[model samples]
Target chain A: MVSYVETTALRSPAMWFTANRLTTGLLLVILLILPFVAPRYWIYFAGLLGINIIATHGLNIMMGYTGLLSLGHAAFIGVGAYTAALAQIHLGLPFWIAIPLAGVMAAVIGVGFGLPSLRIRGLYLVIATLAAQFILNFVFVHWQSVTNGDVGLTVQPATIFGVSLNNETRIYYLILFAVVFMTWFVVNVIRSRVGRALIAVRERDLTAQVLGVEIVKYKLIAFALGSFYAGVAGGLLAYFNRFVNPEQFGLLLSVFFLSAVIVGGMGSTLGAILGAVFMTLLPELLREGALQVGDTFGFDIALILVPLRETVFGLLMVSFLILEPRGLAQLWKRAKQKFERR
Target chain B: MNFFIEYSIVGIASGGIYALIALGIIVIFKSSKTFNFAMGEMMMLSAYFFYAATVTYSLGLVAGFCVALAGSIAIALLIERVAIRPMLGRPFIAVVMVTFGIGSIIRGVVGMVWGPNDLQIPAILSRSPVMLGDIFIPGKTARAFAIAVVIVVGLIAYLRYSRAGVALRAAAADAITAYSMGIDVRRIIAFTWIIAAITGCISGVLMANVNTLTPHLGMVALNVLAVVILGGMNSIGGVLIAGFIIGWLEAVTGLMLGTEYREITPYILALMVLLVRPTGLFGTKEIERI
Candidate 1:
């Protein structure tokens, strides 16, 4: 399947530049106006969508770019979140300080988990990550001194220039800023020499090693980079929800992010954005659909919708892997090509 | 001393059930070269089938067992035909994700039909506790253990002597060679799945009898995963040993420390084992010829 990258490569640079400018300008205009135009609750979801976008971008770097599968990504996110929350509560640190520190904490833990990748690959590595997930989750629950156990921890909102960014619109811009910055950062990273090394490692480590690339360093860097994004996203999530809990960062959440990366287009920035938005909106869409069906059928089907949504999500993941492994990014590329042909 | 003996016995019993489930997983992995992430979900489906038969339909225990077995076999066969069969020759991730999808679908369907509430399956065994010189064992646990052991033994024997079993082994060793030899590798893979579903179903019911049936019963896959990884994914003997080791560790740890520690300990053990020996004990170290 053709990706946007390939399609853009095929077109003239001048036209490609104009198209890129137009799309970015349009997207920026839309994003700026969305909080004002959309319902308040929808803005909240948009904030969540942006947070997930950042997290999915991180996952894409490892799974999509580096060909490393982590079933324990949520654990890293949890570490970032708990670290951020605990820092705020115990250390009495400001949100700005706590958030970056959370990212560092998650990155350190991520590198520790990445050590197993050096010894194992494929399914074995997956299990090692799974181990990280469980062990970290256990700590989150059992280490009550900081985490507060099942009761969960509340996160104080951030402040910038003595202005409390507590409202949904404020958080929306904060997350949007992070999302744009991280997306730009990742795009640059992918184009750089390190990104090339990562892609090379992904294709075949033996071949990459023969070519004089440092496989271990790049792999760990991918982990650190990915988890760093997760950490920042987690901090944002805690802020958005105003609460942090272990349950939110379970294996299911990790699976969701992994699925988003796969379903979006693994190695593409566009894919991450598309996948995250689709996944974030999917449940809400399902809830609405279920509500409509219930209204039409005269039944209280709301209780079943959550599980049904989960099933549909799973089904979508399978179908995408089977029929369109390149994900929605590829699909968008194809549509654009068709339009050009027309 | 008696308390220790009792927990050990209970551990062994639960371990037997774990072995039973792990057997199904190993069986599928052996023939298909794919891990069945849906194994636990398949077991949950079986438990639901039993609940539907005995509780919903008021069928007796025997009927419930038959229905559960049949239901799981059907689900497994359908999965193989629809999902696994198409996934052949595709990327390994596709197969893995398909199983994950299958699992999600099973959970969703089960939740829709049964709702989220926990349902209890009446104890299949007589309620009397067994007293062996001051060490008491619950009858249900003992019976479940015994049944699981019997099934494991029967399966090992089947794999050893049966013609279909030999064909499965041949297919597992080299699918292309077995196919060229006219062994019908596809049929063998399908048969393996059927066997796995049956074993998984029985184990699920047995465990559900021990603990009431819930839609979340599939979460037991995590613990069983530790058992499989520790024992070696490819070895039935290793799985059995590992299962008992983990089960006893869990019981002992839960008794000695807080119950919460039991959940993460197996994963930690698995991580340690994978770090030290990626191939696992008794697992053949895969060599890449290229």
Candidate 2:
């Protein structure tokens, strides 16, 4: 199969790009150019996309590659965002320092949540994760001194050395850099023995156990690693927005993040990137339709559009599930295959 | 004693609403083994239909409410046909997300049609507060609660002894075996959804009395989750018990800790319950592996 794989994909540069590192490298290069060519609003949006990409990738580690359905994974992002925001404000840590601290804090918190997976499995574990979303969001909202209730804590610009990341363009680079490193690191992890064991467990934990995989260690590791990535994404989001609010992280967004993975194609890192890009950008594109419809009706329609947007978004999600359940990444693969056939 | 009676009464009233929602949720979950995460939205949408029936069509409130039931039942079957049917035998995530998607669409359609403002429902109960001694009960909230309790009890009785109800229970217990036993399992599942819709419709009307209706009514999502988790996801009886517990707790928390804390309480409890018992108080424990 490996020899056949080389013969099929190696002959064309386009095929090589689609099937290998070149496409990934090109995508990174394009992401770098995004800030310069796009409007400031879009730059901020793209930075948000990167942050979501990070979270989706983290979720993929558990849901896709490792075969765990963590419905409450956004809570880890909450842990990272709120904790990093707190550390920056109270402990007076630098943004860079606080960001890493967020990841570590999230990983530690995730372990507390992940311990249940050692005994429970499947949808029950998903429900258990749902508890994390509610609890974490509650802490962020009720812990008044730190989170300031729903008002959220105001954040200062991220500083590295003496330079401030004062603009969306600058923050975009920081998010971009973080996403690249994490994606590369995670992809490498999936190629390693740990990755194989995680996949083995996802396939069948009992079978993996018989094959000498430490199910407890691997499950915890998946949770910890996934949560760490979510934390980093949250920290970046907090810093980029220059504010951290409880409302931004909720079960709705958690569902949104999970949907991104599902619609992008589960079990693939590239799929996470495609899903993040599409889901993040989808609202903006959808808003355009609302605007056009409003123009027809002769009044500003943004408020009315809010509800319609959810429906449209939902319709697209259902359509994807019904028509192309494999998501955009799978669609991309199919398109590439067709091109090569010609 | 007055305080206990007041808080307890308020709790049961609200719990009655949640218990109905939970019952709707449980009936569907028992059959399909999936949480109807869309329950809040389903109720919210039906409430809009009820509004359309009562006000737009000039169907008097009783006739309108009955019409709303028919509309909701129709919507449920439509949803099953359009959104859910294609995903049959797909992974659990697809089904869950589709419901979430359906929820989003419902909110949008309702908002688009109804506008963003909360609809001021005409008073079904008399404007006066009814007094028993020193305790004053608002007529609307109390009546809604009573109606909800009566409906829930009646439904439970019907399900326990009725042939159709028995078929639903049998199908829920084991789909394949029931199918071989000559039960039309798909039809039973569809029927459960219709029943779910009817319950959700009643919940919406009750909720409308408590708070005005908006597309954002879907935000009542946490309450349903709390009931299911607390009651045990698959148990109707458990749901009834948990519903009042949560409702009373929320009211007491609002009275004692203030509304913000009250808002946070149910979510915190859900988290605690998940940590302590994921199957809920009555849910069946699942087993896969480490």
Candidate 3:
């Protein structure tokens, strides 16, 4: 059984620090060393992993904490990227200002889409959320004047506090810090009053509603906060890549994000991080291995299997679902738990 | 007059195909409370099956139809056993997500087999547009419309009157009670998927002829989700009507506002429908007891 903390607030700081120390240490080491030790290609790949984490964790808030399935996470990210790109290009706003603003804009629109959750539940709610993705994607692709009419908008590299950071290393640190901060924010929220209410609503909305939870407000709040995370992620992605295209933020990306959450554990924040990393890099690593093997044997196997990316990815998801539904987060948790028990 | 009549005729013709796709979704939703997220992918797969049977091996229409239909039935049953049946007693979300996973898997399979290229479907009907007054509708689209109408009306009638169809209705309404009443709910579930596959195959072939057959064109069938929402999940007639409404709306809107607006219109309409008729046009209100 899942053992949530019994007390709403932890009384012992000692236990808290002791319990989380290993996790913190591991995260710190990964954060410090991976950027340096990883190859340039991997560094770029890892940065993309961070973006996936942002979106996956945001989806975790919606689908996990609030129990609202959103098929439109990528669409919201599209909103974020489009808004940030437009502001950066047309308004000449600094990257620092535009990204957060884009996040805010996406959050507002996320609430607009989230309004349906008040009446619809389960499968109906899912379709309703899907409508948001379709509507937004169409608007993004079609609204030519605002969205550059399918030829995507370009933005300049980011500068923080008058220090222009152009290289991937600096961008890596920026992305790393953003993800860290976002992770910290989500963890803090989980330990907060609002997060508890959100969790309660997800567990059973009627009970929560009967207990004076205000279902509509919470549903909308869940959507806005979740979207805020996605927008921030999307904004970061746009600035990092220096361009935004509609194709990059389509329904498939939405599916990939969901795959991450599912392959991670749904409700856990660490699950989001682990899922994003695995989902993003697994294919690249597989392809790399295939190419290396093909090169050694002097065959054309890699190109033949190159298009099987989604098939392999999908098969992995099914295997995970059938064999280990709890995903990578559970494995990490179990190992840590066993170590602590010893 | 020319533009108006032309758009309407073309509109209805395309809308007819959409209606068939919607019917496929409706049949599946009738049995499983869960939406088959892979329905469009199933359509694409069936289209490929038919194409391979006909064009790849150069088999004529009759042999291709029989083989494709049988293949689709097997595939649907296989999916039921592997992807769906195992998750029978699990949470609803688990089932929905699994269907999506299965969909991705199917898409990948189709991509691998079909080589990610557009397959040219042999013209089943005439290429020239049929002229009526100032309205000139494409010959194939009109033929597709005629075929779709026959299938819809025929199936709807069969479902309404047949004994087996009554059993399906009974099982769908209340599975446990139907089981106690000696109804084979599981068998009905299997039948639902088979019927859904047939619907998919026919629609797929029609759509391939309507537009070019591409693996990615299945994305359009994702719009069936909107139709299901508007019509209500369990309502077959509602889906057919909603499909026409959506089809005509898209055609008229495409005429008035442009093509891009046409795609977005369904979602916008879906949002409004969710706000107003949350249970949808025919869906009974779902009661949640905490």
Instruction: Please give the lDDT score for candidate 2.
Output: 0.79
Rank by DockQ (best first): 1, 2, 3
**lDDT (Cα, tens digit) per residue for candidate 1, span A171-229:** 89988888888887887787778888887777677788898998888888998999999
Model 3's CAPRI class is: acceptable
Residues B34-108 of candidate 2: C-alpha lDDT, one tens digit per residue: 567778898998888888888788889889888888989999889888877777766665677778778878887
RMSD of 2: 3.9
Task: For model 3, name the residue pairs that clash.
Answer: none
C-alpha lDDT of all candidate models, in order: 0.83, 0.79, 0.78
B1-290 per-residue lDDT for model 1 (tens digits): 77888888787778888888888998898998888989999998899899999989999999889988998999899999988887787655557777877888888888888899889887787768888788898998888888988998899789878999889889888999999999998888899899988888998898898888988898788688888888887776687788788888888887778788888878887878766776667778662222
Q: What DockQ does candidate 3 have relative to the true complex?
A: 0.43
Q: Clashing residue pairs, candidate 2? A: A307-B108, A311-B105
For this target, which candidate reaches the highest TM-score against the unseen true structure? 1
Error of 3 at A29 (Å): 4.5
TM-score of each model, in listed order: 0.95, 0.91, 0.92
Over the stretch A100-156, how does candidate 2's per-residue lDDT look in tens digits? Answer: 899999999887876764466655556557767877888888888778999998888
Which parts of model 1 are misplaced by more than 4 Å?
Answer: A1-19, B287-290
Q: What is the interface RMSD of each candidate, in Å?
A: 4.0, 5.6, 3.8
Residues B78-176 of candidate 3 have per-residue lDDT tens digits of 988887887676557767787788788888878767777778977777778777865678888889988987898788788889987898889878888
Better of 1 and 3 by lDDT: 1
Q: Is candidate 2 or candidate 3 better by TM-score?
A: 3
